[model samples]
Target: MIDAAWLNPVIAFSIGILLSFKLRKISARVQSRRGPLIWLPDRWHDINRSKVLQPLYDIIKLFSKQTIIPSTATPFFIAGPILALMCAVLATLFVPVAGISFDYSFSLVVLFYLLMGEILFIIMGGISSASLFSAIGGVREIDLMLANEIPFILGTFALAITFDTLSIQQMMGFNILINPFAALAVLLSIIVKLHIKPFDIPEADTEIVNGLTTEYGGKLLGVLETARIIMVFVLIALFVDLFLWIPSSGALAWVIFLAGVIATGVLIGFMNSLFARFRIDQATRWLFKIPLLVSVLAIGWAVLWRYVL
Candidate 1:
């Protein structure tokens, strides 16, 4: 039997790959385009046909290429992606899969800081690159962080208060059924964090030429992409563990966990297809409004339910 310490990262990595394909297919279908083909007879077409493996292939291809650092880049430039990836992977340790999780009193706090650290590294990478586009992306990332962080914290606080514990495993009850407003707020905040459509202002490819990653290439870029893929799974799994807990034991629990992951991926892809990109100002204002208000109300409700009514 594999230790959960090792098994969790493998599961997370696999889920990330699956999500990449699911998102691609969903987005393609939404746009009335033929989604990825599963198989092709000819070797020439076979490479392109294995749609599920595209992300993996891309990563491998990136690794095979030569790395190029900008002449103006500081030593910290290389450290950025490495640090971001480390933080992202570390964040996964706190999330539970099928009732298996690391137990700690402040797991939630650790998860929060790990995520923040990942973004901070991205910002550092951008600024250190000494590229105009990277600088803009870094600034936008900071803007989005400021706009979404408070509401995210409030939403998590509501959960912590409702559950009366900071350990993620303890908070794994069907809290979404109880305090859906907090769940909604957290979901919205995650959308921003994941850089999904409309909220993808920081790395608006058209506007900033790939944003914070503009100066990154080759194996370094591959590392960043892999980290991002892992993060997609981490964030979605976190949401499922927090909001969509289903009552089951043993094998059944694993099935429900996977279903939740797929459902979340599809929802994210659908939303990405449905919305247009929001400007930075628009994104900031919108995040501060409904999600923040809902989070505040969720906190009030948690308090009331715990104490008064």
Candidate 2:
């Protein structure tokens, strides 16, 4: 537990940065683009960054730029990303990544709350920007969050009811085998939560400019992007922990866990390349429809198997 206090955030940040770069490369490959260069660069120019370090470089570049705060914006424009980044890294500590984590009852609940906080703060950043575009993006995000979180919770809790435990560590197993409906519901929710395509309503640049971060730049934008990178690490790791968990320990376990993460990222990248964006209403409706129904049904089924039958 004590070790997790320092190690978890360090792991999340370090690996999160690399995973962010790799995921971009994955997307680029799916689209048949060359992506970022793999070797260390000769000049560190923006146009041709080293594949492994490009995302980190982008963050540094953003940090070095001028930070502008609009007169209409509130202090939350400054506070939101910092809070959101804190929430993301904190959430990572609750998840078992290659057996390094802090575990106790209801960590799953805590994790969900933290992720919700992350989203809320991002929305706060947008709304505080005082741009109509940001407001519209915030509203769209609210809609997607409302529509997606219900199914996410339903699927997760259904598994909890089946396992009769609230601790994520206690809940580990081949969960997808036992509860495919819950699995599907959660996967769909993950796509929306990660803001992947087809469901990427809020950040649909074609419609809402840069969406939530439309009014942000410099260090603030860098902080927000850092938060996003951490989240990408956390959510995929959470799914692996919950649904495809390994029973081993030590170096081998770490290897398997990382392999799972990369595989999942690749899966998401393909989704990003293949699907077109969904309109806000369409996105919300899709979540509210089959995914929500399946989640509710999964919960009922789990209860029936666990308690009634």
Model 2 clashing residue pairs (backbone): none
- Candidate 2 has an lDDT of 0.87
Worst 10 residues of 2 by lDDT: 1-10
At residue 36, candidate 2 shows an lDDT of 76
lDDT of 1 by residue, 1-309 (tens): 765755677788888988988898899999999787566667667345667777888899999999999999998899999999999888878889887877799999999999999999978987899999999999999999998998889988898998899998888867788999998998899899999998998899999998999999998899899889989999899889898988788999999899888888999999989999999999899888889899999999899999998
The clash count for each model shown is: 0, 0
Candidate 2 global TM-score: 0.94
> What digit string (tens of lDDT, one per residue) describes model 2 on residues 1-309?
357445777777778887777778878887888787687567766656456878888999999999999999999998999999999989988988887788889899999999999999999988999999999999999999999999999999999999999999988877888788888888889889989988878888888898899999999999998998888888888888888877788888888888888788778878888988888888888889999999998899898988898
Query: Where is the poorest 10-residue window by lDDT in model 1?
Result: 43-52
Which runs of model 1 end up more than 4 angstroms from their true locations? 41-48
CA displacement after TM-score superposition, residue 136 of candidate 1 (Å): 0.6
RMSD (Å) per prediction: 1.6, 2.1
